[model samples]
Target: MITKGDGMGGARRHGGRPDLVRARVQQGMSQESAAQALGVTPTTWARWERGEQGVRASYRPRMAALFGVSAVEVERWIEGWSHGETSSWPTTDLGDSSPAATVKSAALLWRLEMDPSRRHLLASLPFVPSALGEWLVSWNYGTPAASAARRGAGRVVGLADVARINEARKAFGQMDQRFGAGLVRPVVVEYLNGTVAPLLRGHYDDRVGSELMTAAAGMTWMAGWTAFDLNRHGQAQQHFGQALRLAKTGDDPLTGVWALAALTRQAIHLEQGTWAVWLARAAADTARRAEAPPRVMSLILVKEAWATALQVKSAEIRDGRRAKQVERLLTEAERAYAKGTTDRDPEWTSRFEAAELNAEVGVCWRLLGEHRRAADCAEAAVTEFSERLPRSVQFNQVHAAEAYLGMGELEQALGTARAAIPVTKALTSARSVDLLQRFSGQLEPYGDTVAVREFRDHLNSELIA
Candidate 1:
């Protein structure tokens, strides 16, 4: 009564599912009957067995029950069927403080990035806001011990290799700033998988190994940043997490601070204000432990201010106390930024100069409903940003436009936003496009005026074309 050839053909065609097929046979259940028990269609069951689709987490328990196997065993069978695809990878375990484990985890992530078939699945992974808290806890309490040189049969890496990675990181970062992530992320991933990954697995002394890990952390952070620019949230989060672990393993708390701050920004973007605030605070604490430069502290404070401003915005009735807190944080950030750069400042901190600070502060002001101050700060940021960062210029231009819109200056807003169109069209940043889209939504109150109509036409043409 097992029903001849039911689901077995699909399983055989897909291959590597002999165990799954045997489980069904032992239970004396046809594919149709199993599907009925699981409350899924027969075709869905067939696809699952064929490795064409994944088993949902909710269905795994029932599946384990039906097969008389543990849930973990069910997962292992699915993973085997998929040939251990990135889809089966767990999002938890940000990697321990061991250099070997860090390298292994980072290599896995780079491979995930490079695999075309599984890249979409990785991007589709949900952003876990709760992970921010776990990461913070680990970062605060985790003390990594020095790892011994590996005796693996891989090439011996050196400081020269570490130098090359840092140089490549700088180049990729510069390109990403100018052109956006769409053009730079692929090349960065290629370098990480093809070049950096092998070096990480290779042999090296503690000194060289630590530097190598730190260098790799920088490149990985760049990879995450570009993914974020392209609005690939889940992929960005994973890269950031891996980067944090790599930094910890490398004994480079400064780089770890950067990763934490990046997570804070991502949390803010996702509107998880509480997580953002905590992550930013954690970044500040880590930076202090590293004795980071003033500019670094300024950057962390700005992130904290941004998160606090959001909290104020989300209040049912504008929270005055939090509003004052935002202002105080911004003031402290400005004071710290004024101390300027030093020899100790990391290369990555260069991007958070005056223009970036003004841009972020303007955002805080706009959220607090101070339209005039927001417009002035935004315009200042626009003027300060150079052509070397076309994407930044475009982003600030849109922010200026939004601030103008906030003040009911339709013509000025439209004109400022129009100025960004050319640059926006040239760049590949999803965030820039998203900002423009939101600005378009804000123009609805203008009721199809000639200026508004013309602007909309231009935007539609540029975006669609």
Candidate 2:
């Protein structure tokens, strides 16, 4: 990605946002005149209008005054340039083709997410049912419409091909858990584009095609999950949306549940608690409507409870009923778990077992101020969760730290937080980094203490450096 002012010599006007250039033109101010008014060089002003230079924060008011607009409007212009909307900043040039072009789109979304100025654009997108409904409309009653076939007209595909796609998804999931999404996401995207896209284009019977679409949906959801873990939230959101379409095409309600649950998880991470709760509820409803297994229902309910817990503070203060509702959902999740038989669980759902439930429960308790219970559950999850799920273990450890901090056990809080540092330092998960940051925030009140200062320094060097 091209930083501001880097491509002044070769910068073109095609790719970036047009507001600045348009403003300059509409104001009828020659580049040199604008520079004179702004107390800058003609070249600098030219670069600014060309979207190749950042207008400093100090200059926003001046620039906005000159443009007869508010400083916030000027800031929006800068945000446009920063976000790659109008800039000719080169992104991953994956060539102009179906999967490759889509891959390039993914790269752009990832870049937009990484840019702090542009991230709000991703996080602020409303999680609306209309978007999901639009994707689902193409499903065509559980049949891959001929037009939906990749490669235009295609050859006979079989069950083996579908099985291979799912197996690859499983492999990617395992790699993601053991390492981090950064290690697995590119590979998954590449595989989806290079291998899976071609297979979807191939001809197959209705049964084979439906199975293939189901597998494709699962793979797409895995891609979205990895992207989410890597903090490319915009890309993840798009992938989840597409996965929903694929699931609908295959009549794969279970996979659709996965997509909605993943979306809910993303919403929660973004602190859009309302969307999270609604999406999770939608997932549970979809699961029931589709007659998904007991295990799937339990997973959805737990996810719903997690979302509800995030909303608990305000909801409890407002109506005083949300807390009880959340508790009821948690109990329902546990009852569903009791009814679930692991024998028929899919590879994806298998990870949503007792340890995960305990971790989610701990999270709910922590958020609700039940620190003692939260600490117990978190400690248990940290101890019992498999090493294969290193990222989750780090999260649980941090939750335990939060619980300790809430209970005023600073020493134990610091120790538990420090213990998770190695795990966090090794993983590329943004969520783990965010958890560590939250833990640091909990220590901010004790800034005068030696332990707090030392922990802060250690955190900066070990996790951030």
Candidate 3:
């Protein structure tokens, strides 16, 4: 029964005849009982027996343990090579900024509103926030423009939505503390889609052009993110492109760099590694051309490093050189961002630091299948986000779990993933669903087991709903 000719020229190496079914029948165990033992659904297990779907590799060990057989035996059956079948699973991964980042960012707004020190500072300064905001931005950016902005803090020119804008900005900060800063993508995108987008689409006077452009740039970036979540890849690309264009209209280099980074994320997701590197590099280049603060520029460089790592192998000559330079530049940026000895910092650059960079690099390593490096970088990222622990924390947790999965530690991976699931449920980020799907896929190896079945049912119910 081992070798059998099928449609293909190659002979199929078949395992036992529906091992789980045969074993259960031999032991006089009912289907439900067997299913429960293996953490699987009766229907799911039934499907496996009926040759509807093959089992995943992760379940092999669990099934082997339950059925008193070796994992190898379970693995053989899991492949289902009865008629010369081949498995096409992707082991290596590429990290794309998920929509969940926006949900997390929106949540931070709630937290920032509560910070008394920030409020008191605004009230006491008697200076327009734009002046202080610009000054702080300068310190982070290392630009003469920031110095000009600091000196220009002459009077209180409270713009029309100053109070509301301040409140919203504070809330954005709080989200970083609650969800983790990296998860701001969806939160920001949602705000724009629900609130900002509609406003932009409505009639507007030329007088509001600057404000409108700023808002549009932000929303366009979000659209790119939402398109990514919906898996409308081409749409996502267009959104990113629009964001960059809008940023230019506003002459907002910081926002422009931010938009380019989003483009890099899309490239990474689409498996266009070279394109990703090119995009990241261009973003950094754009930032350099701008009169942006050093902190902002650092973020762009860090992104460049991320893109390079994704597209280039460390062993390759040109790629290795570029990636190494990116890594060094990223480190430099991290050092500059965290050197917050200044009196104040712009709210925009407040989230920049070694933690975010470490998290990103960790993702880069995780995607490359460097388990040790991935886990280390992930740990560093988690540690970095420990104080904020918002949606960014959840993203990092998933990153850690992914690294654990790469290390062949399913238990840790599942446990880490579980911590982020409900804790971040209030956020409507597609990455959450993607993470759940990933976990389910990892568990599929034990198709007929109780845990796998329970999880499958749980996942199916939610996905269907």
Candidate 4:
């Protein structure tokens, strides 16, 4: 069984929580009944009462409701029961900039994700937009020490081990892009916990260790991207933070920038435009500091454009200046992208080619109310993306359909949307499903039309099946 401890000899001793037992008894509920009410097994509940396991933050409110006490009181009781022991509950905090701390936190996160029960609590955690500021500040200024060789009980790691991780990341990343996160995320999480975590604890020289950390950071970023695609925002945020810390520990500024860009994408998706812009800017600054390749700079510029477009979308009035700013950023992104690939471009940069750039530009145009340009960009993206990339194809198709709807071409919109239905059905991405649902919402005004009605009927049926 997975044990709850700080991984630093802070494991909880056998200490019983008389207060919790009293609360349950006062409610006249057996342990089994309480566990059932709380949607956990009896053993887990018992562990909580016995201080063998710490209660997750997400479950505190439910426990409060069950015991007719405030959530704070439940937390106090838990703390009191623990008798000043360090709670081993998984946290999203990046911890200190130390290499050892980074490895410990990454391992903890992977374990939390691998545990079925803990993963459930993780999914329920809320996304905190406010946390972005602190994270960005830390990443921007925090300078971690260079990774050095470590003496450990595990096997010695070498360059070959790091290469294996990079290879696996590529294979898993391809699956994520084509099949969506729902199918690939769990496997990636398991791999992190079972394979990468062990290698991190193994002995390796500075060169091997740094390369290993960089490779691990890439995989962690992939895990975050998959979680984001699956709409697990909390999980995504934690993974991204961990990836950033890993990159810092590895002394890989470009990978750190990549993590920052992922956070910007999440912020944009959450509609925290200001935070998105800040993150994107930080990413660009870091890229320039690292002298990142033109392709990498292009990716960061597009993210900034997307974030700027969001700000424009949220404005009470059409902000022409901000709209123009977005256009300028996209133009710059195009120019940088045109500079083409270089030897310095990382393997991950290959995925953000013309199709991805156009798709993102299409989104910026859509947000700016330029439906004609958005439609053209979306169609170009759709044609450029390979059939293997079903999620991207469906996302762009949805954008195309939305652009048609904006243009009042209901038939064209319906046709474009219908084209995405098959791919949507096959993919497991929550984002794609959500996009289609949003498109359906846009069709509410045309509900009375026969074609719209029939299309909605077909879409609904396919979505449900």
Instruction: Give lDDT per model, in order.
Output: 0.83, 0.72, 0.54, 0.85
Give the per-residue lDDT digits (tens) of candidate 2, residues 116-192. Answer: 44333444333343454444333323343343233335466778888889889888888888788888877887777
Candidate 1: Cα lDDT at 280: 92
Q: Top model by lDDT, which number?
A: 4
- For model 3, the stretches where C-alpha displacement exceeds 4 angstroms are 1-158, 161-212, 219-239, 313-326, 341-346, 383-390, 424-426, 439-465
Model 3, residue 271: what's the lDDT?
59
Which TM-score value belongs to model 4? 0.87
Model 4, C-alpha of 33: deviation from truth (Å): 8.6
Q: Sorted on lDDT, highest at the top, how do the candidates line up?
A: 4, 1, 2, 3
Per-residue error (Å), model 1, residue 245: 0.5
Candidate 2 lDDT (Cα, whole model)?
A: 0.72
Deviation (Å) of 253 in candidate 3: 1.9
Give every collision pair in model 4: none
Worst 10-residue lDDT window for candidate 3 reads: 88-97
RMSD of each: 7.0, 7.5, 19.7, 4.6
Question: Which stretches of model 1 miss by more than 4 angstroms?
Answer: 1-87, 90-92
Q: Which digits, one per residue and each the tens of the lDDT, describe model 3 over residues 1-465?
A: 334333222223344337657767877888788778878888866765654545544445567677787443554455443311332111101111111222223223222223332222111211111222232232234321111011112232223532343345456546534643346545654565455433433333333433444455555555456556545554455455555544444445667677667777766766566666766766677666655566766666666767767665543444556556656866776766665534333344555666777787787666556777877877777777774655567678777877887887877776777666664564445555676677668666666767557656765665656
Cα lDDT over the full model 3: 0.54
Misplaced by over 4 Å in model 4 are 1-88
> Clashes per prediction?
0, 8, 47, 0
Determine the backbone clash count of candidate 3: 47
Give the candidate order by descending TM-score.
4, 1, 2, 3
Q: What would the per-residue lDDT of candidate 1 be over residues 313-373, giving only the tens digit for each residue?
A: 9989999999999999999999999998899998889888788999999999999999889
lDDT computed for candidate 4: 0.85
Candidate 2 stretches with Cα past 4 Å from truth are: 1-20, 23-151, 315-319, 342-344
Number of the candidate with higher TM-score, 1 or 3: 1
Poorest stretch of ten by lDDT in candidate 2: 88-97
